[model samples]
Target: MRHHVILRVIAKLGIPFIVLFALYVQFHGDFGPGGGFQAGVIFGAAFILYALIFGLDNALKVAPMNLVITFIAVGLLVFAGVGVARQVSRLRRARRQFRRRTASRHPARRARSRDHGRRGHDRDLLHLRGPGPVAVEFLIGHYNYWIFIFLMMLGFYVVVARGNLVKKIIGLNIFQASVFLLYISIGKVLGGTAPIIIDGGGPVTYSNPLPHVLILTAIVVGVATTALGLSLVIRINEAYGTIEEDEINDMDQEP
Candidate 1:
């Protein structure tokens, strides 16, 4: 409340740190293990904490719904549109390169081109050789995978089965977190270091960085999704005076 001095004082003292930690996580991830999504969540959490202590009305005044909505749209368009544009342009470029390859009539060149194509098309996820008969020990070694799978299922169940909107949101967050865990798990190496360059370090084995980059993108998406969801919850509370899904449905069904 406006009159609650203790809360106001503490929030004043702690909010900055929350925001700072979030910033650190976001920017520092590039070198160690931080990224956009983790940053976004921390940023969002700061606001959520502010709302909890300072009141939702104050939070809205600080971060207007219109502004939030505008940013959500802007972020979605920039992220998704850029991704789509990049994909389209890359495909077109690849097509042009393929045509040039096909135009060549040399047999040796053709064979070499075919082999090159096969190698180029090969990817970590999709390989000519399959994962090839998973072993029990191999699966057991990566226990994080199992943990994420469990969290994902739990989150999915809550989101789908619960009637309480807040609980559903919690579940959605859990689901998203589990997905992050899954990505991080893939990037992790059994005995590798962070993908960082050292001045004198030689023959440094490191975890894959690709998944971290992808997770950074996913984090941005997650923040937008979470913000949108919370905004919807606020509107639902205003409209129906309750955020329970069943209650909303009953109200809608009533005369």
Candidate 2:
């Protein structure tokens, strides 16, 4: 790798852009597509590329193990902090609304609040009725769900049937992708645009952003899982001279 000057130079040039893209994803996630997990993976990947090109020792020098661990802890804290902040904000809003309603001396305001609550409950009940009768529109609209099911089953079959460790990891990734697709499909609403409202925009349906956010976390987890699995496979290969599950089992049975 030291002799590969062009490769090293290209990596050096590309790594910064990769990192910048990751930042863009992290910051723009709230308004569009991207999130913290995706950003973290991309950031980590830049380091990984650097390691592959410059050697592990150099990579360690650039990002020490202690520093990596610290960053991971900080990330966890940030995620937890955001959740805590949101929960606290929600509680405060609820408390303020309750107080506002209680402080109102007008009977009409209290009646209106009660009526609104009843209407909300009724809406929930109506939702409980579930999907309407199946039709061509429903089937065509749910094509993404069908893709999810197919990928899920294919991945499941591969995981169960394949004897190679690498194949198993690939299957897991496929399964993870299926889950991502499912979440994205669930988030999308027909005729809904991105969840953004312009000042002068008329009433518009917005796709749910929560599922996309959650998927970003899942994507990070999937990346970590894949990396860990591959690392383990490498270790297993070094120990047993093969990555086939059956061969490994046979070797273990021999002694």
Question: Which candidate should be chosen as best, given lDDT against the real structure?
Answer: 2
Kindly give the stretch of ten consecutive residues in candidate 2 with the minimal lDDT sum: 121-130
**Cα lDDT, model 2, residue 7:** 99
lDDT of each: 0.78, 0.80
lDDT tens digits, residue span 1-255, model 2? 978999989999999999999999999878774477578779889999999999999999999999989997997899899999877778767878877876653333433354345444333311333355634545565678778989999999899999999999999999999999998876665676776546676655556666777887798799889999999999999999999999999999998
Residue ranges of candidate 2 with Cα displaced over 4 Å: 1-3, 20-39, 81-141
TM-score of each: 0.60, 0.70
What's the CA RMSD for each of the models? 9.0, 7.6
In angstroms, give how far residue 73 of model 1 lies from its true place.
9.6
lDDT of 2: 0.80
> Over the stretch 1-255, how does candidate 1's per-residue lDDT look in tens digits?
768899889988999999999999888988774577678778988998899888999999999999999998998899899989877778767878876875753333433344345434322332234364554544665567778989999999999999999889889989998999988876665587766656576655566666777787787688778879998999999999999999999999998
Clashing pairs in 1: 29-34, 37-219
lDDT for model 1, please: 0.78
Error of 2 at 143 (Å): 2.5
Per-residue lDDT of 239 in model 2: 100
